[model samples]
Target: MSKIDPKDIQKRMDRISEIFSDIVSHAETVSKTRCPYRNRHDHCTAEFRCRNQQAAETEEAPLVCGHEGEFDYRSAWESNPLLHARATKKLDEIGKAAAKRRADARRKKTD
Candidate 1:
Protein backbone atom coordinates (compact mmCIF):
# COMPACT_ATOMS: atom_id res chain seq x y z
CA MET A 1 0.00 0.00 0.00
CA SER A 2 1.10 3.55 -0.65
CA LYS A 3 2.19 5.54 2.39
CA ILE A 4 -0.55 7.88 3.58
CA ASP A 5 0.36 11.53 3.78
CA PRO A 6 0.16 12.94 7.31
CA LYS A 7 -1.46 16.18 6.10
CA ASP A 8 -4.10 14.29 4.17
CA ILE A 9 -4.80 12.15 7.21
CA GLN A 10 -5.12 15.20 9.41
CA LYS A 11 -7.53 16.83 6.98
CA ARG A 12 -9.69 13.75 6.91
CA MET A 13 -9.65 13.49 10.66
CA ASP A 14 -10.67 17.14 10.97
CA ARG A 15 -13.55 16.63 8.57
CA ILE A 16 -14.66 13.58 10.55
CA SER A 17 -14.51 15.56 13.77
CA GLU A 18 -16.63 18.28 12.18
CA ILE A 19 -19.17 15.72 11.05
CA PHE A 20 -19.37 14.27 14.56
CA SER A 21 -19.83 17.75 15.98
CA ASP A 22 -22.73 18.37 13.63
CA ILE A 23 -24.33 15.06 14.62
CA VAL A 24 -23.98 15.87 18.29
CA SER A 25 -25.51 19.28 17.77
CA HIS A 26 -28.50 17.78 16.01
CA ALA A 27 -28.82 15.10 18.68
CA GLU A 28 -28.86 17.76 21.34
CA THR A 29 -31.79 19.43 19.64
CA VAL A 30 -33.67 16.17 19.22
CA SER A 31 -33.03 15.25 22.83
CA LYS A 32 -34.72 18.36 24.16
CA THR A 33 -38.17 16.98 23.30
CA ARG A 34 -39.89 13.88 24.55
CA CYS A 35 -39.35 10.97 22.22
CA PRO A 36 -42.37 10.10 20.11
CA TYR A 37 -42.02 6.49 21.16
CA ARG A 38 -42.28 7.28 24.85
CA ASN A 39 -45.38 5.71 26.28
CA ARG A 40 -47.87 7.02 28.87
CA HIS A 41 -45.87 5.27 31.55
CA ASP A 42 -42.80 7.32 30.61
CA HIS A 43 -40.96 4.25 29.42
CA CYS A 44 -39.67 3.56 25.97
CA THR A 45 -41.91 0.85 24.48
CA ALA A 46 -39.79 0.15 21.46
CA GLU A 47 -36.47 -1.71 21.39
CA PHE A 48 -34.92 0.89 23.70
CA ARG A 49 -35.57 4.03 25.68
CA CYS A 50 -35.41 7.48 24.14
CA ARG A 51 -31.85 8.71 24.00
CA ASN A 52 -32.93 12.26 24.92
CA GLN A 53 -33.37 11.20 28.52
CA GLN A 54 -29.73 10.23 28.79
CA ALA A 55 -28.52 13.19 26.73
CA ALA A 56 -30.32 15.56 29.09
CA GLU A 57 -28.53 14.09 32.08
CA THR A 58 -25.00 14.04 30.74
CA GLU A 59 -22.55 16.83 29.90
CA GLU A 60 -21.15 14.86 27.03
CA ALA A 61 -23.38 14.71 23.97
CA PRO A 62 -24.96 11.30 23.75
CA LEU A 63 -25.28 9.43 20.48
CA VAL A 64 -28.76 8.85 19.01
CA CYS A 65 -29.06 5.83 21.28
CA GLY A 66 -28.19 6.48 24.92
CA HIS A 67 -27.77 2.84 25.85
CA GLU A 68 -24.63 0.87 25.24
CA GLY A 69 -26.53 -2.38 25.06
CA GLU A 70 -28.46 -4.05 22.24
CA PHE A 71 -30.27 -0.94 21.01
CA ASP A 72 -29.01 2.32 19.51
CA TYR A 73 -30.52 5.77 19.14
CA ARG A 74 -30.73 5.51 15.38
CA SER A 75 -32.83 2.35 15.69
CA ALA A 76 -35.03 3.99 18.26
CA TRP A 77 -35.48 7.02 16.03
CA GLU A 78 -36.20 4.87 13.01
CA SER A 79 -38.81 2.84 14.88
CA ASN A 80 -41.25 5.71 14.48
CA PRO A 81 -42.08 6.69 10.93
CA LEU A 82 -42.06 10.40 11.75
CA LEU A 83 -38.77 10.29 13.55
CA HIS A 84 -37.23 7.99 11.00
CA ALA A 85 -37.80 10.46 8.22
CA ARG A 86 -36.45 13.38 10.17
CA ALA A 87 -33.41 11.56 11.48
CA THR A 88 -32.56 10.07 8.11
CA LYS A 89 -32.97 13.40 6.38
CA LYS A 90 -30.66 15.19 8.78
CA LEU A 91 -28.10 12.38 8.80
CA ASP A 92 -28.17 12.20 5.03
CA GLU A 93 -27.39 15.89 4.80
CA ILE A 94 -24.45 15.49 7.09
CA GLY A 95 -23.27 12.45 5.19
CA LYS A 96 -23.49 14.28 1.91
CA ALA A 97 -21.46 17.17 3.23
CA ALA A 98 -18.78 14.81 4.45
CA ALA A 99 -18.75 12.97 1.17
CA LYS A 100 -18.38 16.22 -0.76
CA ARG A 101 -15.43 17.19 1.37
CA ARG A 102 -13.79 13.84 0.75
CA ALA A 103 -14.32 14.14 -2.97
CA ASP A 104 -12.86 17.63 -2.99
CA ALA A 105 -9.81 16.40 -1.10
CA ARG A 106 -9.29 13.55 -3.52
CA ARG A 107 -9.58 15.89 -6.49
CA LYS A 108 -7.00 18.23 -4.99
CA LYS A 109 -4.64 15.32 -4.36
CA THR A 110 -4.93 14.15 -7.96
CA ASP A 111 -4.40 17.63 -9.44
Candidate 2:
Protein backbone atom coordinates (compact mmCIF):
# COMPACT_ATOMS: atom_id res chain seq x y z
CA MET A 1 0.00 0.00 0.00
CA SER A 2 1.23 3.50 -0.71
CA LYS A 3 2.01 5.69 2.31
CA ILE A 4 -0.04 8.83 2.92
CA ASP A 5 1.63 12.19 2.27
CA PRO A 6 2.35 14.11 5.51
CA LYS A 7 1.55 17.43 3.83
CA ASP A 8 -1.85 16.19 2.59
CA ILE A 9 -2.68 14.82 6.06
CA GLN A 10 -1.76 18.09 7.74
CA LYS A 11 -3.86 20.08 5.30
CA ARG A 12 -6.89 17.85 5.91
CA MET A 13 -6.50 18.16 9.67
CA ASP A 14 -6.22 21.94 9.45
CA ARG A 15 -9.36 22.12 7.33
CA ILE A 16 -11.27 19.99 9.80
CA SER A 17 -10.17 22.18 12.67
CA GLU A 18 -11.27 25.31 10.83
CA ILE A 19 -14.68 23.88 10.00
CA PHE A 20 -15.25 22.84 13.63
CA SER A 21 -14.26 26.31 14.86
CA ASP A 22 -16.69 27.95 12.50
CA ILE A 23 -19.50 25.62 13.60
CA VAL A 24 -18.83 26.45 17.27
CA SER A 25 -18.79 30.17 16.59
CA HIS A 26 -22.06 29.97 14.72
CA ALA A 27 -23.71 27.93 17.48
CA GLU A 28 -22.67 30.51 20.07
CA THR A 29 -24.16 33.35 18.07
CA VAL A 30 -27.41 31.46 17.57
CA SER A 31 -27.74 30.52 21.22
CA LYS A 32 -27.26 34.08 22.42
CA THR A 33 -30.02 35.32 20.16
CA ARG A 34 -32.50 32.53 21.00
CA CYS A 35 -33.54 33.72 24.45
CA PRO A 36 -37.10 35.04 24.86
CA TYR A 37 -35.78 37.86 26.99
CA ARG A 38 -34.47 39.37 23.79
CA ASN A 39 -36.86 42.01 22.50
CA ARG A 40 -38.55 42.12 19.09
CA HIS A 41 -35.74 44.42 17.91
CA ASP A 42 -33.20 41.78 19.13
CA HIS A 43 -31.88 43.99 21.90
CA CYS A 44 -31.28 43.01 25.52
CA THR A 45 -33.38 45.62 27.25
CA ALA A 46 -31.70 44.93 30.60
CA GLU A 47 -28.72 46.82 29.16
CA PHE A 48 -26.30 44.02 30.09
CA ARG A 49 -24.99 41.08 28.13
CA CYS A 50 -26.09 37.65 29.43
CA ARG A 51 -23.23 35.72 30.99
CA ASN A 52 -25.11 32.40 30.78
CA GLN A 53 -25.54 32.85 27.03
CA GLN A 54 -21.89 33.80 26.54
CA ALA A 55 -20.84 30.60 28.33
CA ALA A 56 -23.18 28.50 26.15
CA GLU A 57 -25.10 27.38 29.23
CA THR A 58 -28.87 27.04 29.59
CA GLU A 59 -30.64 30.01 31.09
CA GLU A 60 -31.70 27.96 34.11
CA ALA A 61 -28.16 26.95 34.97
CA PRO A 62 -26.67 28.17 38.19
CA LEU A 63 -24.38 31.13 37.89
CA VAL A 64 -21.55 32.08 40.17
CA CYS A 65 -23.48 35.21 41.11
CA GLY A 66 -26.10 32.97 42.81
CA HIS A 67 -28.66 33.80 40.15
CA GLU A 68 -30.48 31.02 38.35
CA GLY A 69 -32.93 30.68 35.44
CA GLU A 70 -33.38 32.96 32.48
CA PHE A 71 -32.28 36.53 32.87
CA ASP A 72 -35.26 38.22 34.49
CA TYR A 73 -35.58 41.53 32.71
CA ARG A 74 -38.39 42.69 34.98
CA SER A 75 -36.26 41.96 38.02
CA ALA A 76 -33.32 43.66 36.45
CA TRP A 77 -35.34 46.80 35.83
CA GLU A 78 -36.95 46.59 39.27
CA SER A 79 -33.51 46.38 40.85
CA ASN A 80 -33.14 49.95 39.77
CA PRO A 81 -35.91 51.56 41.87
CA LEU A 82 -35.90 54.64 39.70
CA LEU A 83 -36.81 52.60 36.62
CA HIS A 84 -39.95 51.21 38.28
CA ALA A 85 -40.91 54.64 39.51
CA ARG A 86 -40.57 56.09 36.05
CA ALA A 87 -42.61 53.29 34.50
CA THR A 88 -45.38 53.75 37.06
CA LYS A 89 -45.43 57.48 36.42
CA LYS A 90 -45.69 56.90 32.67
CA LEU A 91 -48.55 54.41 33.18
CA ASP A 92 -50.40 56.90 35.34
CA GLU A 93 -50.10 59.55 32.67
CA ILE A 94 -51.42 57.16 30.01
CA GLY A 95 -54.36 56.15 32.22
CA LYS A 96 -55.30 59.76 32.79
CA ALA A 97 -55.20 60.48 29.06
CA ALA A 98 -57.40 57.45 28.32
CA ALA A 99 -59.91 58.50 30.97
CA LYS A 100 -60.08 62.00 29.51
CA ARG A 101 -60.76 60.61 26.04
CA ARG A 102 -63.54 58.36 27.37
CA ALA A 103 -65.14 61.30 29.21
CA ASP A 104 -64.96 63.46 26.08
CA ALA A 105 -66.67 60.70 24.04
CA ARG A 106 -69.53 60.45 26.61
CA ARG A 107 -70.08 64.23 26.53
CA LYS A 108 -70.23 64.17 22.72
CA LYS A 109 -72.82 61.32 22.83
CA THR A 110 -75.07 63.36 25.19
CA ASP A 111 -74.76 66.44 22.95
Question: For this target, which candidate reaches the highest lDDT against the unseen true structure?
Answer: 1
Estimate, for each residue in 1-111, the C-alpha lDDT of model 2 and write its tens digit.
Answer: 999999999999999999999999987775553544454444343433344323215665333232243454344332454566687889999999999999999999999
| Error in Å for residue 107 of model 1 | 83
Show model 1 residue runs off by greater than 4 Å.
Answer: 36-111
- Where is the poorest 10-residue window by lDDT in model 2? 61-70
Name the lDDT of candidate 1: 0.63
The C-alpha RMSD in Å for every predicted model, in order, reads 21.9, 13.9
What's the TM-score of every candidate structure? 0.34, 0.33
- Encode model 1's per-residue lDDT on 15-65: one tens digit a residue: 999999999999777665545455545544454334344433445533332
Clashing pairs in 2: none
Once fitted onto the true fold, the runs of candidate 2 whose alpha carbons sit more than 4 angstroms away are: 36-111
TM-score attained by model 1: 0.34
